[model samples]
Target: MTPETSAKLAETVDNCRRHAGDWELGITLMLRTHVTIDLTGGLPSVDADLAELHEIADRVGDRWTRAQVASAAGEVALSRGRYDWARAEYEECLRLAREVGAHTEVPFAIARIAESAFCSGDFDGAEQLLAEVAREVEPYGGVYDVRAYGGMLAALLALVRGDLERARAECELARAASEMIAAPPQLTAGLDNIDAVLTARAHGPEVGLAKLGPTLAAAVAAHCAERVLASLCDTAAVLLAAAGRSAEAVRVLAAATAWRAGHPRSVPEQAAVGGLPDGTRAVLGPDRYEQEAAAGAELSPAEVVTLLTGS
Candidate 1:
């Protein structure tokens, strides 16, 4: 956020504080906090925001604010790579939001829970959850937000199942949804990173890295959660290695692993360390691979950026 926007939000927060226990003000702030988390990918500043919102949720008698707090907490859980915990929070959010009204968050909670299932490798469970969300959301005029994120998950499922054509169609839907909403880069890049993986598999990693490298850097620049960027870099490194760029790939993984050390939140993605593939380990041989990764771990962010950009 710009200095001016930051100041304005701060002032608005204070104004909301003045109206303590006011349902309208509390609800509004909670909504804004949720949007802020979505836009900025739950940066550290919102740690305090969620903390305060939780306290406010307990004090406020309104179910709407309580629902919003659960929803916002769900986003924080996602940022921290706690997928199961996130699913629980979203389930609570759905329940609470329903108690207040047929809020759109109800559908979003289901979609996100399905996403957690998808990431957890429970394809059958994810499909069931996604179907449930679709059934619920279709009747409510279909919130584009759910479609945007949900479409991406659909595409991911397609990719894992080797259905490239289905993946392509789902990715198109996801991109269209993003365009419809004019979502920020932080959100859109999730689709892009996944698309890069698909492209790398079909064509080549050189093709994938061309897009993934820059997109990953941009996401990191936006201060998105380390998990978000870590996942992207993990797949990007695989692409690079596939393109016969194992040396560079090792460096990328090493740098990404080191960067992730500061954030210390890792999703359960079938990787031994830093999300690098076991196949990559097999190809590089442990000794040489570890050496390059060690060297990469020592590089500064600027240096990593230089390597990613090939500058």
Candidate 2:
């Protein structure tokens, strides 16, 4: 994003925050919180929104709105890399959605759970959760993110299992689905990250790395931590390795790990991507790799951005 665009967004979010407690703007706040609160806001801001919305929704006895707020809270947790907390929030969202007969939200929550499951390396479990999303959304004839997330989960699962043909097919479907909908910029960023990594997997890592600086900037601007760390940074590391930049790959990996530890200490393990991890480590030599990784772990977000941007 341009600095001017980012400044405008910041101003807009500030205006939105001023009305956060207004009952008349409750639903708007609930909907807009995805980017402003979860993605862009600091922890105090997210927690405040979560507390107020969750409380007011319960007090007003509006289960549907409550479900939506619950889902957003889950997203806030997810952005912070608190996967377990996010799962719990999604479970509450599922429960409230079921109570209110919120058909669309029910599947949306399931897709979210699938995300956590994928992060945890439980591919079978993630598949099961996404199957529920698919079954539920099937009757609704494609409900935006719910439909697209199903395709994305399938794509990654196929990629992990070495089904390149299936991965490509599913990823294309996801990219199309995401583009068709008026989803949040952050949501689209997530899909785009998936697309970027898939490209690396397909042609060669050099191609992806060559274009990644702008991609990383865009994803970071969206404030989707998983997109930044898990998708972009992680894929860039793999690409660096493939391009004979093994030390650079090690540095990126360290940054990825550190970012997770600092922001989302509760996130599940970064599941192995085929032999990429082992191969990269072997190329660096174990001792040298550790030294580079330790150096990387010490870099802050600014430093990580510098490294990513090649500045």
Q: After superposition, how far is residue 248 of candidate 1 from its true place, in Å?
A: 1.8
Please give, for residues 1-311, the per-residue lDDT of candidate 2 as tens digits: 34575576556556765855445455655654665553433444556656777777877677777778778888877766777777888998899889878888789889988887776567898889988888899898869677777888788787777787887888788878887787666556556666666677677777666567566776566665443444567777777888898887888777776665556322223554345557877887889888988897776555656776777
lDDT of 1 by residue, 124-243 (tens): 888888778777778777588788888888887777787899988989987888887867666677888888877877777788778886887787676565566666767766777777
Whole-model alpha-carbon lDDT for candidate 1: 0.72
Q: How many residue pairs clash in each candidate?
A: 0, 0
Question: Model 2, residue 114: what's the lDDT?
Answer: 87
